[model samples]
Target: MFSATILSVLGSVALVAGHFTITYPEMRGDSFATGASQYIYPCANVNQTAETNRTEWPLTGGSIALDLGHAWTYAFINVGLGTDYPVTNYSLTNDRPLNITGKGDLCMEKLDLPAGLTVTDGQNATIQVVTVGETGTALYNCADIIFKTSATVLSSDDCPSNSNITTATVEEVSTNETSSTNSTADATTTTTTSGAVGTTSSLATAGFVGVAAVVIGWLL
Candidate 1:
């Protein structure tokens, strides 16, 4: 009867596991149909001091997978403190240190960049990822930005560039209209100011970096 009892317990455990999986289905990382996928994670502080490249609990999730298309960044900025720790470099290796230092209060969130495009210098770039909701919404940490680069997107043949690449319409297009650079400077200035404002909360609430929370329904 001992063996029978053990089997019964094992069956119950399996049932529970199944229920959990069904309740919380895994989240799929971003994907690209043409080429490789890319993810960017940016974090900055008021001091603007660049945090070390860390893969610890709060910065990066454990384990990662990628092809040539994967990329990641950790950017910090604080206009008041005059600290702009812009992310200079990153890699998707098994063992690499990602840096993040404590401040008034540690703020954590995932940045969702464009589908396949990533910006190294987010501050200078026009468009970037802003937090839509609470922390831990994204799946991976700073360590491993997952993606698979597609050859088509990477190929120059399909994405030929002319002198007026930005405005010129490709033959693949049927018709088009032209527009001006209207509001370029104003938009840029606004973004810069807004970026600074976003850090106010983080710097004001200086706190220790908490242990990275295990993402529920994470994609491998």
Candidate 2:
């Protein structure tokens, strides 16, 4: 019974830390609301005309929230702008997990705009999240933004302050793996992968499960 209880506790901890999703700028269409299994690009069944707006853009120094599906070792956010879909103009890369407090918490990282990066009013922009590792997957969310001058820029106070947040130190992952990007009859696909990160914890958890089973058998 004791072993089983321990196993249950560990499993619950793991589940709590895993599971992330984008919750800002409302993410394109209704598919995200239902957690549908659709690719995250081209506004996800949204019409181009309906996806563009002039008043909803994040300011140059604002932040966005990423409700994590699971704890990740590294994450990056990229921004693209164009009249067409899948704009690829600017990117902000972070080597750390962008944790606001600790591992497995919601990541509310600031979007640091690149120097001189500007977007016109009523422009279409896409924010993409690329997580690294076996659980790694690319998620794309787009928003309509108006780039105001620095003097009149609007910043988001919605992002939680990281003042008392202490982030975990994780080893760096490799960047050699290539993500698959294919254009086919069904739809366009883009895959992004980062090296194996956080796999050790998974393996250790598996080991704990095995040990717990053994202990339970002995007690029985």
Best by lDDT: 2
Q: Write candidate 1's Cα lDDT for 1-220 as tens digits.
A: 9999999999866433221000001112222213322223332111211332222111111121111111221221111011133342322211111222211111122222323334331122111111111232331211212222310111223222222111100011122334674332110010111111122121111111111121121112
Give candidate 2 regions above 4 Å deviation: 1-19, 30-55, 94-109, 149-157, 161-220
For 58-81, candidate 2 gives per-residue lDDT tens digits of 456344555554333334556776
Q: lDDT scores for all predictions?
A: 0.21, 0.43
Write down the TM-score for model 2: 0.48
Per-candidate TM-score against the hidden true structure: 0.15, 0.48
Give model 1 RMSD, 1 decimal. Answer: 20.4
Error of 1 at 34 (Å): 13
